[model samples]
Target: MFREQLARDAARIQNQFDLVLGGLDDLDVTQAMAYTTQGGKRLRGFLVLESARLHDVAEDQAIWPATGIEALHAYSLVHDDLPCMDDDDLRRGKPTIHMKWDQATAVLAGDALQTLAFELCTRPEVGVAEVRAGLALTLAQASGAQGMVLGQALDIAAESAAEPLNLDEITRLQAGKTGALIEWSACAGARLAQADTTPLRQYAQALGLAFQIADDILDVEGDAQKAGKRLQKDADAGKATFVSLLGLDAAKLRAADLIEQGCAALETYGSRADTLKEAARFVIARDS
Candidate 1:
């Protein structure tokens, strides 16, 4: 059930991307934006749609934020893959933006995509002016210096730090780097409906940590081809990860526990949240 819904949502999101990008000029940066945003689990966008469904929000209204998040996520990846960042050459089984184009084009494309997220959020289809403003404000917080950027800065600093980051520090960092966006995606439906977001927030806290832990596990054991990116980069860089701190077995156990906790948080919605529970399980069980 979850897989089917996920696939359907992925297609829907991609179509929306095509529609959005089709209006842009045929420039290198625009083309790069189109290219980079293509293909992925689309999990964030799916969370937006699903959470919207749970809240009885209309899909038409929810899709704007769903598309917006994907655009923002793509921008992050494009920048992250630049020579000055993670320096990767591959993403989603394709060459990284910087590798495919150049650093300048990649930078511009990422910049454009980032702004595009705000544009989508503020579109009339999303909601009233207040809701749009709220979405944009929260999104800025989630993706900016206070959240994802702060986490990225800490990660870069850790590369040269005298001591490796302890478990708590890593946890704190991941909460910003990864969990912030996931939390935003999960909570977007409630924001759209102007409903309470406590349940989804709690659920996403566990889910995001588990997702990162699962990524750590994958870096150790996952297929690079399936993951569509370089694996074991952390190990090569001597970075600490959940697998490194907790050991592989313990890491897996912790991820399982997190999934359980995430699922438990959705008990208020009962069967309406089964797909989200399945998503929590899939996060750990997935190889990529």
Candidate 2:
């Protein structure tokens, strides 16, 4: 049931994105934007919509920020796969933006998508003026120097440092790079409805960290074909990941525990959050 709903939400969000980008000119950069945003888990957008549903917010309004998060996430990936960054040649089993187009086009597409994300967040249809402002403001903070960017910068720095990041350091880095946007997505409903976000925030904190740990586990054992990207990059680069630091058995145990904590955090929402619980469990068990 959860998988079916998640697929539905992913399709709906993609349509929302196509609607937004449909009017764009035939520039290669715009084409790249459309391409880069096409596939992936769409888990972040799902969190936005699901949390909004939990708060009784209408789907019409929730779709704005839901699409917004996905755009921002796409922008990050386009840049992350650039020559100056991870220098990856593939994403989702296809050539990356820079590979399909030029690096300049990739940069422009990523920049355009990033700005588009904030524009979507500020759409008046989302809510009242204050709510719109809050969404834009928080999105910037979550994806900016203090959040995801910080984590990215730390990751690059760690590559040339004397030693790889230890457990605490890697955890802190992932918190900013990966966890911040997730935290935002989970709390988006509370923000939209102006409800207390403590419970959702707790759920995201646990889920986000566990998500990264699961990614590390997948890196070690997942099929590259199933993952749709390169696997064992961490092992190849000698980077310290949850799997590297804790060993496979211990990392699996930690991720399972975090998933438990994430689900338990939603106890107050009862069956309304069963999908979220499933999502948490899926984080650890997914092949990709």
Candidate 3:
């Protein structure tokens, strides 16, 4: 039942994204856009919609806000696949945006998507003016120089450094790189629903940490075919990861603990938060 619901929700968001992209026609831009947006589990958008539902917001009413989060996620994926970053050629079982098109086109496509995310958030039909503005600001801060960008910088630096970081340093790196966006997704959902943010923020924090830990676990054990990119990239790059620093079993245990905390954070919301709780479970259990 949960998987079916998730699939339906994903289709709805994909349709919304298609509608949003209908206004653009430049071949290169559209190609780059399609390459990045075409696939993925759409977990971030699901969180947005589900969190909103938990707070009594209708799914239709939440579509634009959810799309905004997905756009930011797509933008990040495009840049992360660039030669300067992960140097990945494949994503979602197909060529990455940078690989499908020229690097410059991919860069511009990412930039456009990032800007479009804010545009979608600020659209009058989707949210109130203040909510839109606040969501836009939150996304920018999460994706900007002080957040994900800074994390990427540290990751690149760590890859080249003579001394490798220990577990604490690696956790900090993953928190910024992966955790920032996950936190943003949850926070954006709660904000859009007009829910009290204190507990939501706590849930987002724990969920983000759990998500990264699971990602690291997948990197260690998942097949490249399933992952849609090279497995063990962290090991190849000599970057510190949870599995690399704490070992596989310990990392798995930590992920479980984080997921528990994440679900616990939402306890005050009761069964209305079942979707978010299930989402936290999915984060740890996902193979991709």
The true-versus-predicted C-alpha distance at residue 270 of model 2, in Å, is 1.1
Give the range of the ten consecutive residues with the poorest summed lDDT in model 1.
Answer: 92-101
Candidate 1 wrongly placed segments (more than 4 Å): none
Per-residue alpha-carbon lDDT of candidate 3 for residues 1-288, written as tens digits (9 for 90 to 100): 457767887899889888989778958987678667877888888777777777777676688878878888899888888898788888888888777778998899999889888888888876677778888888788878878888788888887789998877877877788788778777766787666777777888888888888888898899888878788887877777888888899989988998888889888988878878887888889888
Off by over 4 Å in 3: none
TM-score of every model versus the real structure: 0.99, 0.99, 0.96
lDDT by residue (1-288, candidate 2, tens digit) is 679878998999999989999989989998999998898999999999999999999999999999999999999999999999888898999999899899999999999999999999999899999899999999999999999999999999999999889999999999999999999999999999999999999999999999999999999999999988999998999999999899999999999999999999999999999999998999889998
- Supply the global lDDT for candidate 1: 0.94
- Superposed model 2: Cα runs more than 4 Å off: none
lDDT of prediction 2: 0.94
